[model samples]
Target: MPRTAAPPRTADLQARPYKPGDKVVAVVDLPGVPEGTTGRIAVADGLTWRRYWVRFDNGEMLGHVDQHALVRARDWDAFRHARELERAEAERAAETSAEADTDAGGATAVAAGGATVNGVAVPAHLLARSKAARERLGA
Candidate 1:
């Protein structure tokens, strides 16, 4: 049997993160507009059904344009920079969490001449007082 290609997954599709005032180029022709027309995103409003209103250079203003039909004019450079920043932030967060775990683990160890109570050191005198008080209260 001949093998068939799998349908594209949602993650395989590039996300359209369009915003107002973004310069874009249409990938498909629309009413009164041709492909490769330069435009500015006038407004972006939608929740589940995302769309954009674009004012093309050819004096055509199209509304309810599907985000997939347009691409940012500088998507390559802009997306690369954004991804690099996200990666750097993630690395910094991981390092910070690792440092915090190490610090907490070290803190739980009993220090010299002191007993730990809830991971914090209590002086010998304080421990003795607490023992006596506990005995008096029968607790």
Candidate 2:
């Protein structure tokens, strides 16, 4: 009997991180893109290009962007505060779960404290802070 290989998972989730409701900034325009601004990123993804997507706050329009051209996205203060709150909540959960498995708390903490960038572990707080600070400054 021949052995079968697993299917490849080609998700671009490794590219950029954006929540369904989060606002983003557009960095560039690809003529190949459908119809959106070059330098400006719209918040919603409804009007986005190939792999790039964003939706504005008012929920008016969705922009399509090229996944490759997406150089940067604006991270704001509100997003920071929200993350801090999220971390606190996660820590609390870890504490509770620690009783079931002591090792679990440490593992959770380690995972929560950092995020992966191109498969490299980077401090989540730092990324959050920089984006938040830049957003605050923009406002």
Candidate 3:
């Protein structure tokens, strides 16, 4: 007698953009996570509303994440830009602190209320104003 081959898996009727082996990022926290995280698409299901099986960097596998809750991982250029802006803000805050110390005859002067960036205190109103300006400028 001849050996028989296994049957092929069933194909989904619905169409979707993503497929297995695609990289993805979580726009919102996955189940049991404290916050949102990124993952790889281990399985893609076009038939269901909950469409992806995501494998996170930490070795955890999420069985079902909706397509809307995830985006292509390559689309994080804006996030990278925001991180660069945050680093620049921290550096500026440190420089301002040093200048204030020098002007105050080496005495430490604590800001009453402000936004702290990278452990440096920046004036809250200034930070807020700058943020508004950036938003207006579409940066």
Question: Per-prediction RMSD in angstroms?
Answer: 14.2, 19.9, 18.8
In candidate 2, position 23 carries an lDDT of 39
Residue pairs clashing in model 1 are none
Off by more than 4 A, model 1? 1-14, 76-139
Residue-wise lDDT of candidate 3 within 32-68, one digit each (tens)?
5423466788987766565888888766788767777
Ten residues in sequence with the least summed lDDT for candidate 1: 6-15
Residue 75 Cα positional deviation in candidate 2, in Å, after optimal superposition: 7.9
Give the per-residue lDDT digits (tens) of candidate 2, residues 59-81.
43434545544433343333344
When sorted by TM-score, best at the front, the candidate numbers are 1, 3, 2
lDDT of 1 by residue, 9-96 (tens): 3222337568899998776689998877889999998988779999999999999999777777766345445546667878999999
* Best-first order by lDDT: 1, 3, 2
Off by over 4 Å in 2: 1-39, 42-75, 101-139
TM-score for each of the candidates: 0.44, 0.26, 0.40
lDDT of 1: 0.74
Top-TM-score structure, candidate number: 1
Query: What lDDT score belongs to each candidate, Candidate 1 first?
Result: 0.74, 0.47, 0.64
Error of 3 at 25 (Å): 0.9
Q: On a 0 to 100 scale, what is the lDDT of residue 71 in model 3?
A: 62
- Clashes (N, CA, C under 3 Å) per candidate: 0, 15, 0
